[model samples]
Target: MSPALHRRLPLLATAAVLVGLYASGGLLYDGFLSGRVALNLLADNAALGLTAVGLTLVIFSGGIDLSVGAVVGFTSIFTATLVERHGVHPALAAAAALAVGGALGAGMGALIHWFRQPPFLITLAGMFLMRGGAYWISTESVGLTHPLYNRLAAYELPLGGRLGLPVTSLVLLAALALGGIIAHYTRFGRNLLALGGSESSALLMGVPLAGTRIAVYALSSLAATVAGLVLALYTGSGNPTFGLGLELDAIAVVVIGGTLLRGGRGHLLGTLLGLLVFGVIQTALTFDGRLSAQWGRIIVGALLLAFILVQRLLHERLGRRRDPIHTV
Candidate 1:
């Protein structure tokens, strides 16, 4: 394989795995191939998709944000409390949550850059702070009965027959499309990839290191906040407990999507396929009533391992062929 093709092998593998899972599900379950079920998979995992997409950008820049899940949880409860308790408009509440998330992300990024700190430590502290702040706001779940929420909860864009796309799913698809464009076609995206592949090389090439690092984290937090909003819309309520450990899920899906966990080459399209793989496992387990949820976890774990190994091999191959001056 060419060096470029080697970079894309994991993405191809992910697509093949998704197709196999869908085929197996169709064979095993009565309604597995239905359009509704397919769309439901997307709808059910919209928040997760959003989070993973955001994390994708960060990972592409050779960074990790452990605070994504906490941000989601905080945004959900923070928005809900504003709408329910403080009589704040849902739109306004959402804006506030996004602002807070972006600020937190930028702050973390600045610390990582200016203080020469590791992203892991800075983001870990951020995770604890946000989670604790969420608990401080409300220990209990806050229900949302806003008219806007009601309308959104009930709204659906019908395709044909019994098939319809929910708002959350629509958002997920839109974000995926836009994310693909941004990741591949934009200068910022190139800078991010370069940074992830090798930061020293990125700086040597005059890629604005400080701005890219700070902006990527801010963008990731923004995505996470949007995910929290989607989750709130999906569940019609928000709890401080929402999105517990979801950062790990986002990371897993990104990795499974063929994005190198070490940073550098990957695609948002792969992340979508990875999320589908995740949904397929959950849906298949649901179809197979005899098996417990633990089985789903086991299956996911196995697939995650397989993908990681594939990535490792690809990395070795690329390392051998890569020019010393151009790491990406």
Candidate 2:
């Protein structure tokens, strides 16, 4: 296989799994192949998709952000508290949430880069801090009864013939498109890829390491905040505990989407397919009355493990090929 095709093997595998899962669901469940079902898949996984999109960028730079899920939780609760208790407009509250998320991300990035700290440790601290902040804001779920919230929640764009796209789903698709463009067409994206591929090489090539590192984390946080906003609107409430353990799910989707866990390779579109694969499995389990939530998690865990093994094999094989004589 050509190098390009070889690199895309994981992405192709992800797409294949998605199609196979959906086909199996259609065969096993009534009305599973309908347009409505297809749209519902997007709607249900919108927040997750958004999170995965941001996480994909981070992974592309060979970094991880454990704080993503906590940031989502924090943003949801913080926005809710502002709107419901402080009589703040939902829009303004959301802006505040986004700003806070960005700041948190930047801070973590600074620590990781300037202090030469491990991304994992820094982001883990961020995770704890954000989660605690959410609890501080409110220990319970905050319900949104605002008129604007209700209107936005009910609004859906008509897609022909009884098909419609929810606002959250639309945002997700738009974000995905923007992310793709940024990843492929911009200097920052190139720097990010180079940084992930080899930080020393990137530095030698004169890439703006500090700015790129900080910006990627901040961008990831912004995405998490957006996911929180979407989740708040989708659920009609913002729970302080929302998105608990979701960072792992987002990471899993990014990895399953073919982005190397070690950094330096991946596509945003692949993450979308991985998200769909996850949604399909969960939805299918729900369709099966006999199956439990534990089974859904177990299946996803198994798939994630399988993909990790594949990635490891490919990484080693490709590494040797690239450095035939020096590789030992």
Which residue pairs clash in candidate 1?
Answer: none
lDDT by residue for model 1 over 182-257, one digit each (tens)? 8999999999999998889999999999999999999999999999999999999999999998998899999999
Candidate 2 lDDT over residue span 31-53, tens digit each: 88899988998899888899898
Model 2 score (lDDT):
0.91
Best by lDDT: 1
Candidate 2's error at 209, in angstroms? 0.4
What TM-score number comes out for model 2? 0.98
**Which 10 successive residues of model 1 have the least lDDT summed?**
319-328
Deviating ranges (above 4 Å) for candidate 1: 324-328
Return the top candidate by TM-score: 2
